[model samples]
Target chain A: MSVKLAGELQSGNVIIVENNPVVVLKAQYNKSGRNSAVVKVRMKNLMTERISEAIYKADEKLEGVMLERKDCTYSYYAAPMQVFVDSEFNPYEIHEETLADITKYLIPDMTDVCEVTFYEGRPISVLLPKTIIREVEYTEPVVRGDTSGKITKTAVLKHTKHELQVSGFVEIGDKIEIDTETGDFKKRIA
Target chain B: MRRWDLFCRVVDNYGDIGICWRLARQLADHDGEGEIHVRLWVDDLESFAKLCPAIAPRSPVQAVGSVEVCHWSTNFPSVDPADVVIEAFACELPLTYIAAMARRPTPPVWINLEYLSAEDWVEDCHLLPSPHPTSPLKKYFFFPGFTSRTGGLLRERDLMSTRVAFDAAAEAVFWQSIGIPPRGNEDLRVSLFCYENSAVPEFLQSCVEGPTPIRVLTAPGAATEQVSRWLGRGLVTGELVRVGALAVHAIPFLSQDDYDWLLWSCDVNFVRGEDSFVRAQWAQRPFVWQIYPQDKDAHFVKLGAFLSRFLHGVSEPTVISDCWQAWNGRGRISFAWPNYVANLAEIRRYGEVWACQLDHAEDLANNLIRFVREQV
Candidate 1:
């Protein structure tokens, strides 16, 4: 186990809590006024499969449980489970429920590799690449003179049907780069 | 009855001890729930003594009123853990004391009492639990705030009543006690308390040159230091320095309750840091705040968040905003002074409305008790 500051905690990092390993699904850092910084996390217990939310002082120390991970491509889903094939064509299955919010971004046979995390030799969580390019399936007509990206409108992604906010300059069939971790629109891809 | 151990480490100024002492006093003096026993452990008793004169600075262990005070040291003694433990302002708890808490049959409810903020995120973070890295203990973060969704600001039970009861005779007596002469009806009574800022001299010069006479009651320490530097002499307690229409009176350090009286009597208050800032709001008087500066100008964002909520309904909020920003070293005081002074009567009436709105929320001490009870 390696020591990690709570402020540095990112999605897919597993840490020990109450003698149980929990994978962080989301982490948010906020600092206001003269108050000490804090990190709020949404995590699920690996052993108990229980979801819980917690907050910690930004500088708080925690024991990070190192997990084995492999770069893999998303394969076809099999009902309750999602399948992935590693570089050596090794197949691994993780529960669709465990994927949480990431399920909205998953597309089969994608070129970009996703990370599959293993805890005690058992597949647990999947972490997507930092950025993913997806085409807009539907959105309102682009507004003129909005090059600054200050104006935003919701757009539906082509394959996943996932809806997210995009710059007002984007329209149907426009490819956009999105930050996978935050699911926020990054930039318009030519 | 539940017992609570409150640990406070004075980082620099008296703000830390001032807040901890107020919370500790209120927790101990609570009338209901079988009377909780509170023990406040402070590292700087000298600073604590300034707020409560009864505290013996050198004593390793002592009692002030119903609450016990301990001089926290490197060689912390072994003692049984209380039912609840409060780490004020995110101060780390002694490892040994934490171990004692873990060893207890039922571990204490650990809480990290965070600093006050008006930002929206405070509500989202308030009352969230943080599990210990190795131990089984969990500590919750409690934030003091102006809104109901967050843990509310600190206010003693009889504070409002006491302010209401303080009449003109009482105000005169308080002025006599502080060794200040009577002021003219036209004179604006201002209480100044703040940290080091380049804006201080300019603000003082503006006050001196202004047409209206302003009686500036400067609190000892930072406020007095600023006045002394401006006068090019050492200014002591009870010393009065006059220039133009401004009369600066250096007052000695006042106890906590007396400080409340000072805020109540003043026409305008210039307060710094957490304790006095919250007290000035409770005083229901027009006031200006000088927030403790933070790295990379982050404090400006905090100041804006508070001002947005504070000046929500005002027609020309910039009157207060510009003056406050200038006082905090953003713009020119001379430019903001005219508009700010013109809106004084409106702001004074607005202060009463704002205080009434704040009073609707549950106070910090009671909210803490409720949150702890629900958790434990």
Candidate 2:
């Protein structure tokens, strides 16, 4: 059975291949002049984490990759890692390497659902939000009439309980969103 | 082989005309089966003459190496119809030329040579064809890019050998001849040629404060003036200054070959816009790029895309990315120079590797021959 789902595909969505679920690591739309469009995707094995690339023809009918995302609350750390509880009260402990890049976005006692990529009931990779709200620590004074647009100043970021200064265009107390994948400021949250 | 007429309108710079002139020369010199005759039509002969020096301004058409240089003016020339026509950088071809191409027995190949980019989409769009609405001519989009799948970089045949044989002592003598003395010990020699930038103050500050000494060589422009204003003193005509540990040297304007030598001889080259940036890659040195700023911040996306590809295999990719971003952001120079200095060895290795990779790609002249042959 085949189904088509139309939305921006998030990284780590699990697709069935040879009756097994494979986790996607990246997805980008490939477009060309008068040529058929394709979703150029790279995926990693859920168990092995080995990456592979695949192209899905745009007009072709393909099986829909279904994934499950749940809202969860962070709980106490479980030695060398952190644990969280889903809405169904299921506890999931993730390794330090699994949450390596996005750990800075995590805040204890905060309730947010981690979208887990599942393949026949096994957890794969995690997909983080496009932007994360963080408080800025320091910024240089903005100058006037110098809008030649060729220079960037560095700024620091300070969370409520921790401080991590990043080099970017930001000001003190500005709630900026950081791309979990690229670790860049996406936008300033209103 | 298709006979192509490449039209170059020099926008008061040698770089633009220099590139087109080189391409035209390459096309004419091709030894393949099909004959390719290129008529290089240039608006500014004066600027072009500076690069070649042998170009006779009085002659309507003169042979320079292999290509025939035509003095393009308000009035178009009555010439044999070419099999292909190229409008460099979207420069409009003369109406007479356009009409001639339209009336040719077999419509000529029309191409709009686009600016180079490392963006993901460029690969997909490169060489895609567009039909002229009125004329039978079909125009192809030729994009100069860093990949095998795209039109390759503008490289001369002897470029690498020439760069290798370029005498350092001779270059020092040339600098002295142009009224700039040899750099002092502990000086970070820098060459600056760019559009007016607001980041000049911060860049100057960084140069003045960095652990290493800096000797900045500027082209004749507002960038020199900006440096002068920042120092609170007009550049002392012939002497270097001790601004902290940095020694800033202001040099005179250089010819194209001299500029290439400057790039080859410097610790860091801050190049603005197109031509010099490409040359810096050939220089095989660590560099900071100042992209031509766009109205809607589109250049930011272009800059980021390039950085993403350039730093793909680099050690301390984050630092390189940070330095590039800081260089292009709003007057922020705190991060780049310090981080870059700390990672000099790694950066230099990456530069060397990148230059070798670029060398494997076919040069502009050879690429033009192949492109024309396929189209014809």
**TM-score of each predicted structure versus truth:** 0.95, 0.63
Chain B TM-score, candidate 2? 0.90
| Off by more than 4 A, model 1 | A32-35, A142-152, A167-171, A181-190
Clashing residue pairs for model 2? A151-B329, A151-B330, A151-B331, A152-B329, A152-B332, B188-B213
TM-score of chain A of each: 0.85, 0.61
What's the true lDDT of residue A147 in model 2?
A: 50
Alpha-carbon error at A48 in model 2, in Å?
Answer: 50
The regions of model 2 sitting more than 4 angstroms off are A1-190, B1-3, B12-15, B29-36, B50-52, B56-60, B170-174, B232-242
Model 1 lDDT tens row, B243-323: 999988999899998999899889999999999999999999999999999887878888998999999998888888999
Per-residue alpha-carbon lDDT of model 1 for A11-48, expressed as tens digits? 78999988899989889998844656889999989898
Q: Which digits, one per residue and each the tens of the lDDT, describe model 2 over residues B1-376? A: 5567889998745557867876786677666566777888888888787677788877888988767788998877688767778888667678788788778788877777767777777676666654332346666667788888888888777789988886768768766776777655656677777667777778778877777767787666666777788889787545466677666667765667777888888878888767788899999887888877765677777788878878877757876677666777743567666877778768877988889988998876676667767865
Candidate 2: CAPRI quality band: incorrect
Best candidate, lDDT: 1
